[model samples]
Target: MLVKMYYNIKIIIFKLACFKLALPADGATGEHEDTSQPRQVTSTRRTQVSVRGPDSPKIRGEVHAPIRGLKCLCTNAHSMGNKQEELALLLADTNPDIVGLTETWWESTHDWAVNIKGYRLFRWDRKGRKGRGVAPYVKKQYTSLPNSVGSEDGQTEMLWVRIQGGQGQRDLMVGVYYQLPNQGEELDWEFSGQLVETVKSRDVVIMGDLNYPDNCWEEQSARSDRSHRFLAEIQDLYLTQEVHSPTRANALLDLVLATGNDLVRGLQVLDHLGDSDHCLLEFTIQLRVSKACSKAAALDFRRADFNELRRLVGEALRSQRVRELRI
Candidate 1:
């Protein structure tokens, strides 16, 4: 009976091992098996987020806008004189991208911004009774930064503007300056030195009735060095014409200096506005990117050794024997 029980137990253990082998492993099961629960398929559907390009449809209007050239006008309107009507007419007809008006009597006048159609105005007021100021009128099509600096004596005004161009964009820092009349050499030197020191390090255009002409005025002969150095540092946009006037005479006072690329090509003195003492100065600037220089090609000239040639000639002469047979 004990032997029978041991044989039965061995048979049962073999059967159990076979049953365990027949069953499926932990994660491995045949597709046809209905005994196991169906696996929940975790979806891997990639959420495709649409990305927008720089020239996408949302910004198509701005991308499609045509790039245009920028035209800047600079003038010293002679604040002592009342010539608003004349200035308005001239500005209206000229239609400059920006107009820099210097020596404006801002303290005396209540209305600073003289609104012209298709143009936006910016002005800096002067201190009490000084009558020195600068104003810039930009076209409505373009945008400008908020005014930062104004003049107290109505002699200087600085404004910043951003202009979009075909190739890229440009920042314009324009200054309208009107030096004190009859300030003498010392004052002129001091003022010019200040201006040079202030603007020499930055990209800027100093334009307006500088009062100091390129040529030595009777008043400026003593301080000619200061004026010359100042003019030399900044490229004179009015080089071709001695004096930009309706009539011919050498009196170049109003000027424009381009700090970046010498984009200023020409400056034309427009027809005088009524009886205003100062004339309007208009400038034409062409924007362009600088190009890289190419390398030069090597020359292929033959070089001869004089000593070698001489030695070869001597050897040839020595080798050749002039044999003369006497007849």
Candidate 2:
């Protein structure tokens, strides 16, 4: 009876060992390949992207002519999305001295990547707001200051930098601003007096996505208190609205307002760039002596080949027979 019981125990233990051997090893996922099934992609991240417009700005290796003193370009990105890359490329192609962008919709989590080659970026983030922000990039080559001398503080979502150059070294108070929809009237009323005071006799250029419809521009708005108030401030400040063309969908959302029209020149609306609803507002400083009209000679650096010139001079002198080679 004892022998029979021991034999039964051994048989049960053998069966348990066989079952354990058949099972998968520790930490095994039990994964299997199925040719008919689509392979799953691991570690994929969702890329936030924007719908690029038909007239999205393209990158060209060509560099445009530089404006003396300052050449500024303003545009509303609507939503920068992945187009900051394209925007930087476009800026390199156009080569503006300063760039103002509105509606960037930039968030804290976003990786700041819209750095042009030689510009210093000043940003005023729109905290707790969606699809609204303001920033400006000023070229390092220019003489710019953190703030203009004798300048006062501005309202929220506004940034200013003083550029001192042009005819007679005239100082320009450059700024980038964004007033939220239904918030314009308040801004005009609240900051109107302060802004006028802050600019304080300096030539002013305050630009960005004002968001006011073009119909309201100049004097088309009869009932819009905000429009009237905004326009009133502009007139009171002696700022000329340089952008007459529609920025987005037949509406002039982006604006370029200058205090002294004589301080700026060649106001032009450029083609739509990279996924932006608005167009580019391009202009240069209007110096007392315009480069084109003045007889003042400009150094022709682009056509100059210093080495070739040196070689030519050396050859001419080497072959010439001098009448008297005196000191």
Candidate 3:
């Protein structure tokens, strides 16, 4: 019985081995069964990304105050007589405190034609000639007077005006000049003399088409002798040329010169007017006008008219009751 039992045990072991061998291998069927723990599948298409650190700064916009001061607009209206409507439109749009125009092409015949409303016109029309004129329009509220100084031959056209400032502001001397491209040194000398005298008195702002393309305003140098002398004079007077960009075809012919750095701000070269080749210049004159004082008296309760006030109130109440009853 012991032998039979041992043989049966061997047979059972052989059958178990055969059954284990018949089973599939671990990866032969293209399947995985990880009972211990799930495996992480590696991917070759993964991309690396970066994140901002805690020290990174947050982006924001800058805040600035609104510009409040005297605004001025200047342009070279090659022939302003024919472009009056365009100038009018521009004045209406900008509403500047002062307007300066060079090459106005005005004569005695345009006396009544070039006047703009709400502005006191100070013009220097070319005498015995056709082209090359300068005009400055000061607002009517300010007291402005023409102080023109030019040659008898009308070679140097300079329109000088003294503008009375408001209560705390200083009076300003504004000059509008137009130098002929081919003008001789005599005209330049005359203009420089007058300019020096004007600057010696009060603060001055000179705006116009000076026709000095040879000037390098940034470097404060000039190629031509004429422009060199002019630059030297400007530097001696401690004046600053505010316009940087080109106003005409690849040349900064239009200029806005001021006595002090604080005198001018926000200088921009705008589009051309009419058929003119030069661009418009707009800037702020860093000056303020005081508000006009009104003569208004406040109510005084010490001298009360209570009896009349009560009577009016009673009448108004009775009238309101009558109207409500009628309704």
Q: Highest lDDT: give the candidate number.
A: 3
User: What TM-score does model 1 achieve against the real structure?
Assistant: 0.53
Off by over 4 Å in 1: 1-67, 146-167, 182-203, 214-223, 235-249, 289-327
The predicted structure with the larger TM-score, 1 or 2, is 2
| Tens-digit lDDT string for candidate 1 (135-214) | 77777654343323323332334443433322222233455556654456654555444445434223356566666554
lDDT, candidate 3, 113-155, per-residue tens: 7888898898788777788888999886655566545444545
Task: Quote the lDDT for 119 in model 2.
Answer: 88
- Each model's lDDT comes to 0.49, 0.62, 0.72
Q: How many residue pairs of model 3 clash at the backbone?
A: 0
Arranged by lDDT with the best first, the candidates are: 3, 2, 1
> What is the Å distance of residue 263 in model 1 from its true position?
1.0
List RMSD in Å for every model shown: 28.5, 31.4, 37.5
Q: Quote the positional error of residue 78 for candidate 3 in Å.
A: 0.7
Which residue pairs show collisions in model 2?
Answer: 57-273, 57-274
